[model samples]
Target: MSKGKRTVIVTGANCGLGFESTKYLLSDKIDEWHVVLACRDESKGKQAIQQIVEIDQEYASRLTFIELDLADLDSVRNFVTNFNQEKLPPLKALICNAATQAPPNISTTKQGYDIVFGVNHLGHFLLTNLLIPHFAKNDEINSIVNVTSDTHDPKNGTPVPVPTYGPVDKLIIPPQETPKRDSRYATSKLCNILFTYELKNRLDKSDEFKNHFRVNCFNPGFMPETSLARYLDPKLFNMIVEGEGKKYRKPIANSSRYLADLVNPQLDKVSNGVYYDGNEIIPSSDESYEVSKQLELWEGSKNLIKTETDFIL
Candidate 1:
C-alpha cells in the first residue's frame, strides 16, 4: 500500500452501488487513493477487484479486499483487527453501504438479533465507532456516509407501506409475532437515519471530532435493478419493478454518483447530520429527527455492542 495515499473502506462493495462508487473514486488520480473492498464473500470481492483493474489499469495496485460479514458481531470485530494490522494510510472515509432484506419469514442473525436490523444498523454503527480513532488521526476532512433509503419515510408510499419506527427493544429484536417482511426492511432503513442523526450529534458535541469529522446519510432512492430485492418473490418483485417501481427507480450508476459526490474530497463544505436525496439535501421524516428516539437507539446500540461483541464504544 502507498504510505501517504488517502484510504477508504466501502462495505458490500462486490456489486451495485458499492461497485459503482468504487469505480468513480478510482476513475481519476488513481494513485492518490487506496480503496478497501469490505465484502463478505472473498470470491466475489476478488472478481470485483479484477473487473475494476481491467477497466482502470492505472489504479490496479491501489485496490484491496478484506472480508467483512456484518451479520455477525464477531466478524465485524475481526475485520477491524485485520484492517489495523495492515498499517495502511490514514483512513479518509467509511461508506456503510451494505444492507439486506428478509423474506416473508422472520430471520435472526448469528447473534439472535433480527437479521435485517443486525446487518443494516447495528453492524455499521459498531464499525463506525471502532474506526473513529483512525479517522481522528487524520487532519484532513473525513466523512461517514450511511446509505439509507427514501422508504424510511412513511410518506413515500411506494412498493409497500412503511411501518412506523418503535422503541429500541422492538427495533432490535424480531417481534413476538412476525411482521410483514417489507415492514422489517423499512424499520431497518429508519434506524439507519436515526443512527446517523445521533452519531452526527455526538460528533458535533465532541471537542476532538466536531471540526474533523462529518457524518451524513444518503437515500439512493429506488433502484429496482439491483439484487436488493432478491429476497422477494420473483414474480411479484418483477411485477412491481416493471410496473409501479419503474418510475422512481434510478440506474445504479446514478445512485453511485450521488454517493460518490458526498465523499469527494474536493467538495468544499458538507453539513453534519444532513440527509441527501441524490445531490439535494432534504429533510428526513419528522420521526427521524426526534431527539428522544435518537438517544434511545444510541444507548440501546451501545448496550447491544457491549453484550454481543464485548466491545465498548
Candidate 2:
C-alpha cells in the first residue's frame, strides 16, 4: 500500500457512475486519493481497473477492487472484514453508488426484500453503519454521500411513479417490483434520501460523531446511458436506450463528475443534509422532509438489518 493518501470506498465502482467517479478521483486532482472499488464482480472490477490503466497506467496503482454483493447481507459483512484486513489508508469518504432496478418477475434479496430496496438502500445502509467506526474524522476526511434519483418526486414527471413510503415490511419485496419496475425504482430512490437524512440526524445527535461526520444526498439527473439498470430484462433495457429515452439521457460524465464533486475537497463547503445536482444545492421531494417517515424508515431498517445480519446499528 502506498503511504500518505486518503482512502475512500465507492460501491458498485466497476461501472457507470461509480467507474467514472473512480477515474476522476484517481486522476482529476493532486495524487491524494486511494479508491477501493466495492463491486460485486471481481472480474468486472479488475477489468474496470485496467480501463483506468488505459487512462493512465499510474491510476491502476491508486485503485483497488473488493467484492461486495449488496443483495446479500452476509456478503456485505464479508466486504467489511476484507476491507479492514487490507489495512488501507484511513477511511475518508464512502460513496454508496451501487443500485439496481429489478423487474417484479425477478426475485428479491435472499432476505425477501425488494431487490431495489435491498441493494440500493438496505445494503448501503448497513455498509455505512458498519463502516462508521472506521471513518477518519479529521479536517479533510469525512463525507458520506448516497446517490439518489429525481424520479422519487411526482413533480419531476419521469416515467417512474412516485414512491409510497410507509412501513419497512411493505417495501421489502415490494408488490409489483420496480424498473414496473419503475415504481420499485422510484421508491428505492426515495429511501436513499430518507436514509441519508436520517443518518445525518443520528450523527448530529451523537457527541462522538456530530462534528466529525457529514452525510449528504446527490442526484445525477436523468442519466440514461449508465448501467444502473443492468439487473432489468435486457430487452427492456435495450429498448429504453435505443428509443426516445436516449434523447434526454444525461451523459455519464456529467453525473459521474457531479458525484465525485460531492466528496471532493474542493466542495467541502457543501454542508450536511444538503441535496445536490452537480455543485448546486437543491430541494429534494417534499415527501423527503417528513420527520415521521424518516424515523419510521430508520427504525424499520435497523430491525430488518439486525434480523438478517445480527447487527444492532
Candidate 3:
C-alpha cells in the first residue's frame, strides 16, 4: 500500500448502487486512491474489478477485495482482525453501504438477532467501532459514511412508526402492530442516522481521535432497482414510490453518483452527523437527532458487538 494513497472500504460493492458508486469513485479523473470493494463473494469482486479495468486500466489495480458477510458476526470480526493484524496503514474512508429490508420471516443471524438489525445496523456498527483506532492514526481527513434511507419521517416530532430492535431495547411501537412490510425497514434506516450522530459525538469528544475522523450519514433516496429493493414484496417498491415518494424517487445511477460525490467531495465546509441525499444536507426528524437517544443507541450497539469482538471502546 502506498503511504500517500488513501484507502476506502465500501461494503456491498457487487451490484446496484454500490457497484455504481465503485465505478464513479474509480474514474480516471479521480485521484490515486485505493478502494477496497468489500464484498461477500470474492468471484463477483473480481468481476467488478474486471469491469472497472475496461473503464480504465489504472483503476483496476486501485480496487481490491476483502471478503465480508454482514449477517455473520464471526465474519465481521475476522475481517477486521485480519485487517488490523496486518498493521496496514491508517484507513481513510469506511463507507457502510450494505443493507437489507425486512426479511420474509423473522430471520435470525448466526448470533440469533433479527436479520435486518444484524446486517443493516449492528454489522456496520461493529465494523466502524473496530476501525476507530485506525482512523486516529492520521489527521488527513478520515470519513465514515453511513448510507441511510428517506423513509424514516417525522410525524410532528416523533418518528411515527419505528421497528422493534430488541437488542437496542427501544421500541416506538410493538412488533406485532408495526407495519412489517416497509416500516420495519424504515426504522432500521433511522437507526443508521442515530448511530451516526452518536458515533460523531464519540469522535468529537475523544482526546485520542478528535482530530482524526469525521462521521456523517446520508440517504441515497428511493432507488427502485438496487439489491435492497429485492426484499420488498413483488412490485411493492415501485408501488410505494408512486404513492408517497413520487417526488423524491431517483434513478439508481444518479443516487450512486450523488453518494460518490458526498463520499469524496471538493467542498471545504461540511457539518458532521448531517444526512445528505445528493447535494443537499437534508434535515432529519427531531427524533433522529435526539442527543440522549443517540447516545443510548451507541451504547447498545457497542454492547452487542463487545461479546463477539475485541474492539477497543
Highest lDDT against the true fold, candidate: 1
- As for lDDT, the candidate ahead, 2 or 3, is 2
**Model 1 regions more than 4 Å off:** 1-4, 103-106, 175-181, 307-313
Each prediction's number of clashing residue pairs:
0, 5, 0
Off by over 4 Å in 3: 1-4, 28-30, 84-90, 155-167, 170-182, 241-243, 308-311
lDDT of 1 by residue, 1-313 (tens): 3433778899999998898899987864633667899999999999999999899676677888999999888899899999999877778889999998874464777788888889898899888888887773555788899999988887777776685676767867776655545587788888999989888878877887777877899989788767788777789888988898877788788789778778766676666789998888999998899999899888888888776444323
Q: Which lDDT tens digits does candidate 3 get at residues 246-267?
A: 6666887777777776656343
lDDT of 2: 0.81
> Alpha carbon lDDT of residue 97, candidate 3?
95
Give the worst 10-residue stretch by lDDT in candidate 3: 156-165
Number of the predicted model whose TM-score against the real structure is largest = 1
- Return the TM-score for candidate 1, rounded to 2 decimals: 0.93
**lDDT by residue (tens digit), candidate 2, 200-234:** 88888888787887789988876766766656678
